[model samples]
Target chain A: MKILVIIPAYNEEENIVNTVTTLKEKCPDVDYVIINDCSTDRTEKICEKNGFNYISLPINLGIGGGIQTGYRYAYKNGYDVAVQFDGDGQHNAEYIHDLVKPIEAGEADMVIGSRFIEKKGFQTSSMRRAGIGVLGFVLRICGGGKITDATSGFRATSREVTKFFSANYAQDYPEPESIIAASVSGFKIKEVPVIMNDRTAGVSSISPFKSVYYMIKVTLAILIYRLVGKKWR
Target chain B: MMTDLFRMILLGGVLIYIIVIGVLMKKGKMNLKYSLVWFLTGIVLLICAAFPGIIRSFAKLIGVYSEVNVVFFLGVCFLLIIILSLTSIVSLQSERIRSLTQTQALLEKRVRDLEEKNEVH
Candidate 1:
């Protein structure tokens, strides 16, 4: 099965080389592309220096838009599956095959690399954990599925979902909301246990100060999607 | 008939607003889609100034206590609607920009690949 790993990056110059090298070593069979979300730093220079396959956006489209760009490319290129691997060095490239296996087997339309299924390795901060728990509960009730890691960015999608996401995707705070959207639209989602590492370089865009706001916004987005999301036949 | 001073002032104000919108449109400072709304608003204001009795009767019909109150209420509502429309416009513009950026990047990559193939040839 043809697979594409989509690395959505913004201002991640420090970690970009390590992340790409790790992917090259670990997931050589999988074709990968980096969507540089108009990083102000030297990320584009690094990508060019490495001769990595990358797309440097003229404007910063944020994470959601960057990932969607990858989806669009995957859809156009006729990739059977597209996996979102974070560029912040938190997500492991080694788990890419595991994330894509369910989709490859036709057992699921999407597979999420979940940290909480086995509850091993860098579970994030306590406050964020609580927020994720709350989101999990809400998704279960509204989306009619048990998502252990609603906010996990390490996920894979089949061609059907890749095309769908290319057309319409949630913007800011997209991870949790996207799950709800997929569920409501009658897509099967599965989570696999995967260990994640702490980001070795660069501060996260979502600061501790914004965690509360993030929680509130993502929760509201999920709920709103439940109301407005269209069900597929 | 309303007082001459009030009528003249309202007429002049509405005329000035229309002129400003026209100038903005001519200067390409405003999108036609958005300027249409403001143009309609200016026309409505002009109509109201031309015939205060229309507003008065409409106010009485709507059970507004005073004609002036109806005018103020209508003004506030128009402003709110304009703000809402502006937000919608902004959202659409951002969406378009995102699509353009993604398409541009994809095309650039394709061009680079083709150039590399040509060099090899």
Candidate 2:
């Protein structure tokens, strides 16, 4: 339904081509836009070499900014739905359909692919898993866990949501906030079970310290949401 | 009693806010939005503390001297409005920056497309 998949990438020289190529193989008709966020590495050059359609930010705007840019593009180009897939090949291409199913059925405005929904993947370190679990509880309290994956970047949204996010998506660690925002703004949110693979190449952008800060940030943001959210009961 | 409790909390929040904002300014992360809110909040708290009469005076104006409840309620309401207004401003400015960036991107794309069409012609 005029679907656009946005992959926000940084220094994923090893995995960008494979991720883009496989998406082409699996969802040939779907438009995939890779946002190369000022990679000092050859990530942008690789996309150019392969003739992939992409946007290269002049400065590294981070994942949040990159995804927001993608939202703006999808909104301006009149895409009906937008999916965010990681450039690291960690997200499963096959489950993309599942992620978008709720949107297609008109049941949800936002759909996130959860690795922990069924717990079907190589979960990261104990601390990180604990962090995610804590976030899940906080999200649950915020009326956020109707869907399993609160932080999964692998998600799709209907045009209503795409337009909304195109206008205002969070600029950093946005998944949780966006979920809360969508829910509060009266957009139905849901989740699909998907398996996340280990990154086939490159390092994760989030370090342990950042994950800790991220957990705290999302938790506080959720608290703020509960205090002043539209759906606060 | 309720009025006193609310006064204590309000004053404490303002004091902490000033200190935290002072630290932010020291770190060079203080923006106009932040400083403005901080300044206004500081002024409100200082005025309330320095001139405790105003709170009671407002109560008197409303025809209630012993009705200290109104004073506390007014303070809470005032603080809440300030916080909400500050957040709205920050959100609005962020939206502006995003729109400008997107416009710049589209213009760059148009120029590239025009150059390509010229080459083809």
Candidate 3:
């Protein structure tokens, strides 16, 4: 299959080199592109230095817009499958195959790398875990089920879904929210048992304050979207 | 006659909007606070346009007389504040709306994906 790996990054110059090196070593044949969302840091320079194929936006478009750009590239180039990788090196290359297997087999429209699905060694804070649980409850109410890993960043998509997400992807903390958009547009999704490793270098974008803010904002958004999201569809 | 005709047409359109908002209220499309704002804003603008002379009288009563500069300054300030308020209303929901939509979409897509995987198995 013509697989395309899309890495949406923001100020991860420190971890990106190792991240790309590992992915390349693990899957040499797969095509990969990094969308460097306007970073004031050395992210773009580092990508160029490593000779990795990438697109650098003039201004930071956040996660949603960055991923949409990747989807668009995949759709235009006719990739049979596409995957989203993190710049922080939190995603394990060992699981890339596991994440992509369903899409390659035509079993899943999209496959997510779930940290909680296999109960691997990775651990998050208790407060964050509770926040994810709350979000899980909200998703269940809206979509009629539950996911052990509601906010996993690693995922793969089929050709049909690449076009869909390219046309419409979320920005600013998009992992969990994107599932609903895909579902509404008539795409399939699956979660695989995979381990997400700890970040090798650099800091995570999410903080305690941002987490609370994210929870409140995203919850309100769900209520509002349930009321008016159909207009766009 | 042409001016009157144009005014009537515009008024008809505004009145239609007011009616639509009213129906939305009945359907629970809008809550009490927003409904009140839309209702009052619609009425006030319509009244101001319908009676243009009210502007001069009101301006004079506000102690500006017919002084164009004072009235213009105050009008500009009011317009600026109104624009700022509208922007806030839009931005207040931007991040929240975005996250909510994404989360909801993720849930729906995940189920569909899992079902498809099962089919292949």
Candidate 4:
């Protein structure tokens, strides 16, 4: 199967090289693209210097739009599957094949790599884990299946789901909202066990002050997707 | 019991508003699509200024005690509508810009790939 790994980087100069190199080393045959999301740092220069395959967006499109661009690229290139691998070092490269297996077997349309599944490797702070718990509960109530890692950026999608996301995607806080959207649209969703590393470089996109706002906004977005009811399909 | 001074001031303000809109349109500063709403608002204000009794009667029908209160309420409603429509326009434009950016980036990658192939050949 033709698989494309999309790495969306935003001011991730500290970790982008490590992330890409690890992926290249771990999965030698898998094609990857680094989406340089108008980074203010030397990220674009680094990609250009390293001769890595990358796309530099003209404007800052945030996380959702950045990943959507990757999906668009994957669709245009006729890839059978597209995997969203984080530009940060948090996500492990070895588990990529595990995430892609279900899609390759034609058993699932989307597969999320969840650290909570095995409760192993960088379990995150207790407070954030509780927040993720609440988000997962809300997602389940909204009929998004039992996704333990509702906010996990490590995931893979089948070609059909990739096409769907390229056409329609939420702009802000898209992870939880997209699961609800896909579930409502009748796409099968699954989760697999994967270990994640704590961020060795660069701060997380979500700050401590913004966690409350993020939770509220993401909850409302999930509920809104449920209420809207399969409009994208 | 409207004062003549107040009525004249209202008429003069409406006239200036219409003239400014006209000037903006002539200078191509305002798009005709968006300026239509402003023009309609100016005309309504003009009608209200030319015939004070209309507002007075409408205010009375709406059970508002003062004509001034009616004007304030209407002004707030119009502002809300206009602001909401502007927000919608911004959302549409941003979506378009996003699509354009993605397309441009993809095309650039394709061109780079083709150039590399030619150099290797």
lDDT agreement with native, every candidate: 0.90, 0.79, 0.74, 0.91
Give the DockQ (C-alpha) for candidate 2: 0.17
Local distance difference test, candidate 4: 0.91
lDDT of 2 at A174: 86
Candidate 2 — what's its lDDT? Answer: 0.79
After superposition, which runs of candidate 4 have C-alpha atoms over 4 Å from their true positions?
none
* Predicted candidate 3 versus true structure: per-residue lDDT over B1-121, tens digit per residue: 1145645765786699789999999999987765675676567556644764665577667776553344345446656665776688787676456444434433443464577689999
Error of 3 at A147 (Å): 1.7
Q: How much DockQ does model 4 earn?
A: 0.80
Give all TM-scores, in the order shown: 0.95, 0.72, 0.68, 0.97
Tens digits of per-residue lDDT for model 1, A146-180: 99898899999999989889988998988998898
- Compose the digit string of candidate 4's lDDT tens values, residues A29-139: 799999999999999999999999999998999999999999999998999999999999999999999999999999999999999999999999999999999999999
Clashes of each: 0, 0, 19, 0
Tens digits of lDDT, candidate 4, B1-121:
4567877887899899899999999999999999887888878777777888999999999999877777667767778888888999999999999999999988988898899899999
lDDT per residue as tens, model 3, A1-233: 89889998899888888888988999888888887877889998987677677777655668877787777778877899899998888888777788788888888888888777767767678888888888778866877246667788889999888877766666666777777666656567888888777778888888787888999887766655555555223
User: What are the chain A TM-scores for all the models, listed individually?
Assistant: 0.98, 0.94, 0.94, 0.98
Q: Model 2 — TM-score against the truth?
A: 0.72
All candidates in order of lDDT, best leading: 4, 1, 2, 3
Error of 3 at B51 (Å): 6.4
lDDT of 2 by residue, A1-233 (tens): 88999999999999998999899999887898888887999998898788787887775667777898888888888888999999999997888788777888888888888888788896667787777778778888887756556777899988888888776677778888888888878788887788899888788878877887788888898788777866422
Give the alpha carbon lDDT tens digit for every residue of B17-100 in model 1: 999998998999988978988887878778778889899898889998777777677778888889999999889989999899
